[model samples]
Target chain A: MSNVSATLPRKARVPIFVVLVLVGISIAYPILYLAFTAFRTRADYLGNPFGLPSELTLQNFISVWNNYGIGRALLNTVIVVAVGLTVQLLVAGLAGFALARYPVPGARYISGALVSVMLIPSQVLIIPIYLLLSRIGLVGSLPGLILVYVATGLPFATFFLIVTYRSLDTSVLEAARVDGAGFWRTFLSVASPMAIPGLATLLVLQFIAMWNELLFAYILLPNDQLRLITPALAQIGGRFTNDQPFVAVGLILTALPPLLLLSFAAKYVMSGLGASFGR
Target chain B: MTSPVLAAPVASASAGATGARPPGRARWRTSERLVGIAAVAPAVVLVLGFMVYPVCYAIWISFNKTNGLSFDYVGLDNYTKLLADPLLHKVFLTNLIFLISVPLVILAALVCSVLLYERIRGWRFFRVLFFVPNVLSTAVIGLMFKSLFSYRGPINAVLAQFGIPPVDFFAGAGSAIFVIIIALVWSGFGYQTIILLSGLSAINPEIFEAATVDGAGWWKRLWYITLPNIRGVLALVSILNVLYTFTALFGFIFVMTAGGPGYDTTTLDYLIYTLAFSSTRLGEGAALAVMVFLLIGGLTALQLRVFRVSEEN
Candidate 1:
């Protein structure tokens, strides 16, 4: 039961910060190098592989974005991330709200089961889900990918929201109910607003997960026109193997959305992710 | 996984179970039960439909052979085939080989977190910067590394700058797997650090203050008080890493080496992907998947046992 202080002498902090700088550079260098190189032409890269680009150019970015089917893939990604995330938040949110606030007999068991199922390694389910989706002819379709994403994301969403809702005060919900609001009204209005911070954090995290999810997207969406952004980027990389600048640009385009979002909302991302791991 | 935080909720949850007395509490309990049922039904049905059902069906299909249009029941045949297949044996060996990297990852994470927890300057910026890699798509990271390690990439370019001969990183099995391990640790280091740092952040500073007053130096205080207190979280992060080491290597392998240089980088998950989709041997692939699930299950059970034992101490 001691205090939570992290005090250090002035002289000691310098060496520790040096260590921090070393660790930070190693973690950040690959990403920064790739991004920086994308702004260069192949000749520029050959001239200096490790240094910043001599002259910035958007040619690589424009070429990859317009020509490599990234435009179509970006649309497909939007459908999956937007629609799939909505379904996940809705289903997981409602279930967590019920389990947290309601008195259903089997709710606890269901909540526990959903959370436990998340521990099941996903590769095992890939084969069967592929077969199932193929049998129903949902393979190569956006809806099929969305369904799988929602299913996979449900456990985390439900698990996190349940913990979040349980930790929330119930007095507001009680007041809303006293005003003659029905269950849906109370939950949609009171509980959800109170949980907005958590909800937004989870939404961004889910977006990043789906935006970057490649394996399932690879297996499910095999059709050329319907491929998502990640697969699109990977395919272009393989196609333009000799053109390092092209591949670099493709990687940057694919990585940009999440990196930008994360940079802006790092607080939410860190806190949300920390909350998940802490549990 | 069996920590008091996660485990304690189970007992209290049963208090609101069904049958809150139909006669006495009938009026109030009706709406509550109805809302609860309606609320949870979606998640229950979705999980059953997607996750639970598919897993069970996969186990069932593990016993049969299948072509595009036909299926034949072959009880235990798939398992027997998997058992005797030399490639799978190689895959298991490779998995063991790759596992040597897990502890290194944990150590890196621990060092970073402990330093940050010691009030290192700009730790917040470093944390966010480090975490940027974790958010990037695996394919992006994988392909970037693949290019960076290519014969003429920056790595070799730098080597040549130092007057060293050019080296083919992916030309040999050892070097290829080495690259894969580096990518594995490099990508994973950030996320694990953030988790471990949070665990460190939760530690009471008074513990350190008291120790310092008693003439304990930083290293001694870290070794004795900090390490022992976060034993639960260390176990948690390591256990989670076990699962990732087992399966998550697939993305990196696919983009980086495609398990090349004579199947050197192929893990069990990668092997299953190649078998099922590449070779179109669904039965054998399904069989391998079941084995992976069992291995992960055993690891999880071990995690819980360790977590619970630590709780008692």
Candidate 2:
């Protein structure tokens, strides 16, 4: 590996470096544009859509928050994502723990079922999920949306956690059991602590996924008053095509939580990806 | 340390075997089983309720004419109608066209990952920057691209600077699909790069060194050593990209072109959405949904088979 780069002559190095830089710019430029445009006044954007803003202002953000009901949407998103993430983690954690540590009857079948469902894209289930939710009168409710998120999220979350828990050092768990710790005690005191990195990775991943989820949230909560951040942004983007700055603000707000999470837990997220696919 | 650690299970086993302890052990074993059942029950219940049941219901409703409130037995009618639907044909063709983005993504990811693996200057920053798109919501990326490629947007502005007329990118099917493909590749290649990077990292560095000693140049080494070593990961990434193109492009299409100047860019997922919700053709939508489910399932099975074959080899 060391000599691989050294063997490249100086001339080849420059072009490779330049190509890397160009690719980096292509990735960064549009995001930077969104950020710059979000802070620009409508008039400034209109005058010079591609140029640096003459003056940055909070007016676009404020306008979107107040006029587009993005504030409410943000709150809705927070409630749904927070509650859904907690439930999904708890349920998946328990199930993953059981499958990993205990001789649960039909464990193999249970795992097979989970893995199979993980392959079924949620889009394919949207029709029936919608009908099922409506049948239970959860058609336009946050709790209903939360239920869908947790359910759809469970298969992969449980599968991931199962892999995580299974890879844990068994000696520690054995020691815990030797100390007279029962199942829940061993799980909570020993297994759970050991699996913090996995849980954290799962938390960050599921949070981002649930936060960015649109279809079920949009379809299930068709009422504008209860729109989540993503669907709200889509609505704003679709409606105000010419109001670029306003739409940009909405887009930024919608993306901010996950981006913030990514910045903080990027290592965990990347490791989680590696772990998921490494098997 | 090993003695005590090893003794715990043996101690419990011997105690259970003792004359006075059989009933107690049996009780403990039963309770443990119950606890295990209790622990796994929530996930099982949720999966049964939402996933398993919804799929069965989707299959059932695919054979009926229903609009959420009503169902009339129209056995094979929904399926036949969808099978004959020209719009569905166009949608599938559009999806096939979008599949073109998967190879583009794989190629881009391959080059980027290989370049980054060389530890180029600022590789770390580029890695994070490339991954920024993966973190952002696809809707946001879609809208950003939509704005950038709009008639008066930045892309057109850049063209004007080059003495070319502004292009209305979304005015036609070809350009609209082009814009979506660009967005998909831009946002997609990064995640694949990360995956490919991990795959590349798993390769034995000694092989590269040995290849270098044999006078294998960079391209030759990559084509021979790097490419063959990461073939499994490449296949995984391809399938993932295909899946993303099939299911996850809804957000992009929803925001960017809204399925087009006509049915020109309507992907299968987006078609299901329009049919079930917008057009209130739930029966037909469910039919298409079933078809999509089977398509994905078949793809996944094929991936597993590929892995199994690769493992055997």
Candidate 3:
């Protein structure tokens, strides 16, 4: 092992190995550029695209937040995520509980249909949904976007939670029942404890998806104020074609929320969510 | 209350199998059914009304020839026209490019996960750092990368540092494809790495310990032990990644190149968006949508079958 490590020749010697590393760096360069330019100034950016910023400044970050008003976009994203994930979790949880604990006729059929929904693109149904929402005067509202988010989120969440609830030992529920617990009581006390990891995983995954969604939100919400971070950031491109630093800071900020949530939720997301689909 | 409504029918079905429905049992079942329906009715109604109903309406509209909203049934003409467009063929080819990128993503993800999994220090920080891009919305990432790869963008700047000539990543077709590839790889690999690492972490430590005790080194342990243990997860992640790649968002291409440098990045998703919204060829877009759905469904089914075959071993 020591010999193999030593003979590795301090950074690849073979021609093919050298070529592969070069290719890897080539693939990686743009990403590195994004990181590097975050600190650059407009003059430096235009004059020398790849050189280190002549002078470091936090001015771009401030401009991205204050001038571009991404701070509000970030707040709106939080509101959307909080409401969307809560509604999704509650609705899916109740449905999954019924399917798992109660005798729901055609449960298999309902589950199958929901799973099938996962296969279809949002494009096919989004237009009609738009027209329907327009009829009810929800074309440009935060609540309207939340409604669409919940609808889109339901199928996968239900499928996931049902599998999770079913896989738990039923004896725990029976024990609570023997101790005079009713259905909701047993569920709240017993099943939910064992299912927290699954619930957390779903929340993280769905939150990221909702937070990152652009198409429906862009189409459904016409007002710039109601626009989520995605469409908002997209609009920045219209006015500033050459402002690379602004784009860099916006990209970094936009990436922050999901990265933070995913980092914390990584352990649960893997073990809990991955386990449900194993069969 | 919802449970009783939803469960009644199933309970009754199970009871019917025993062939004795007593009066009290029937009354209780009736109430239970009502409760159960109430519990699940919200989600069911939403799915039916929003998802199923919209799809039905859209499919119906595709058969007709109208503006975004009007009434005219020009049956099959739109479909015929859509089939004849040379651009439709381009869209199919673009979709093939989308399909081709998936393996590259999976291979990169597997490599990154293994490298990061070597009981190394600062594992958590590196994992988070790598995954940072996955959380960024595709539109933002797309927008940022568009600038980054443009003629005066930092990518060209960096090449100059190594005494190399500046390359116009957006000007030429090959370089344009490279830009899209970079964004696709940049945005995707992080998520897969996290998932793959989880799979790696879940392998029973005892298995590795056993391999080590038998004098299995890193390569031998990885080849003979780690790979086999995470096979199911590897299949699942690959399937998920393939589906994600197939549905490459219009947002990225729209922001980055706009399928530009002369239509170099016109994947099926981008083409479908254009056909529906831009070209007003709703029927063709619908056809394209159906094609994407079928392709993803076929791949997912294949994945499941492969998974099952491996499990039997």
Encode model 1's per-residue lDDT on A26-112: one tens digit a residue: 877888888888889888987778777889888888888777788889899998999999999999999888777776555557666
Off by over 4 Å in 3: A1-40, A54-58, A61-72, A167-172, A175-194, A272-279, B1-30, B116-129, B194-237, B302-313
List per-prediction Cα lDDT, in the order shown: 0.82, 0.85, 0.71
TM-score ranking from best candidate downward: 1, 2, 3
Rank candidates, lDDT, best first: 2, 1, 3
* Model 3: chain A TM-score against the true structure: 0.86
Instruction: Give the winner by lDDT: 1 or 2.
Output: 2
Instruction: Tell me how far the alpha carbon of residue B16 in candidate 2 is from the true structure, in angstroms, after superposition.
Output: 23
lDDT of 3 by residue, A140-250 (tens): 888888988898878888888888887788777656656876557766778888988788888777877888888887788878777778877777764676787888777
TM-score of chain B of each: 0.89, 0.88, 0.84
**lDDT score at residue B94, model 3, on the 0-100 scale:** 69
- Reference-based TM-score of each model: 0.93, 0.92, 0.82
Residue A5 in model 2: lDDT: 68
lDDT for residue B291 in candidate 2, whole number 0-100: 91
Docking quality category of candidate 3 according to DockQ thresholds: acceptable
State the lDDT at B159 in candidate 2. Answer: 88
Error of 1 at A70 (Å): 0.9
Alpha carbon lDDT at B20, candidate 2: 25
